[model samples]
Target chain A: MKSLIIGIVAGILCTFSFIPQVAKIIRTKHTKDLSLITFSALSLGVFLWLIYGLMIKEFPVIAANAVTLILSLTIVMMKIKHG
Target chain B: MKSLIIGIVAGILCTFSFIPQVAKIIRTKHTKDLSLITFSALSLGVFLWLIYGLMIKEFPVIAANAVTLILSLTIVMMKIKHG
Candidate 1:
């Protein structure tokens, strides 16, 4: 129960980190100041974490990173399209 | 040695997940299609992870999430400013 709570809390906090930017982007449809290198690096990193999670059989890590990867990827795509 | 390697890999992977979005924002100065709810959830998740790491005395988790928090926050700030 404790671990589950911890996992849930961790997931929420980490996921929410990108809210402000996402909101701004949605509102203004702009992403010129964003860095492609950073996002690219970040995407790769998340991919690796996904693998790691799978290896360790950590469902929370895998699930969280998977969703995050998709969401982050979408934002990157939008930045490219609208930039 | 193995744990260190795992930590390093996980750190890099998780931290790098935001690279592409950051890069896009930097190059275009836009972020309109992004979702605030998602990012907010992600950030919160990471923050909680940081706390969890600290509670568990996991240096790798602490270091990785701290840096990630800062970088993610920066992107969010930029998105707001330029959007």
Candidate 2:
């Protein structure tokens, strides 16, 4: 139970941290200073994590990475579109 | 062994994904567009993961979260210093 609570808290923190970034981008529509390499690499990393989660059949990991992957990919797409 | 490899790969991906962001910041010294709330939250999240890893006595989790905490914290510090 303690571990589960900890996991939930940790998951929320890491997963939603990207929310503000996404919101900022959407509101500002300015990704000029954002690095393409960073977002691209992050997206790739998230993709791997998603796969790992799937391999291990971990629902939380899968869900977290799935969301993160989308957000990171959005950033990457925004970087391309806006840059 | 397979799970270990998967964990290693996942750790490498997620932990080091911040590198390009850090490098970009160092090179550009422009974080006006970056969101402070995001980094602050991320740092907190990584810190939790570090603690949870210690609690569980997971070496890989500890090491990975430790490195990620440092990088995320560095980003937060850089945001403050450069902002």
Q: DockQ each candidate and list the results.
A: 0.43, 0.68
Candidate of highest DockQ: 2
Number of clashes recorded per candidate = 67, 0
- Kindly list the per-residue Cα lDDT of model 2 for residues B1-83, writing each as its tens digit: 67657667867877888888899899899887788999899899889888888888889889999999998998899999988
Q: Could you give candidate 2's per-residue lDDT for residues A1-83 as a string of tens digits?
A: 68667868988899999899999999999887777887787788788888888888999999999998898898889889988
Model 1 complex DockQ against the native: 0.43
Best by TM-score: 2
Candidate 2 reaches a DockQ of 0.68
lDDT of 1 by residue, A40-70 (tens): 6666777777777877788877887887677
**Which stretches of model 2 miss by more than 4 angstroms?**
B1-3
TM-score of 2: 0.93
- Please give the TM-score that candidate 1 achieves against the real structure: 0.68
TM-score of each: 0.68, 0.93
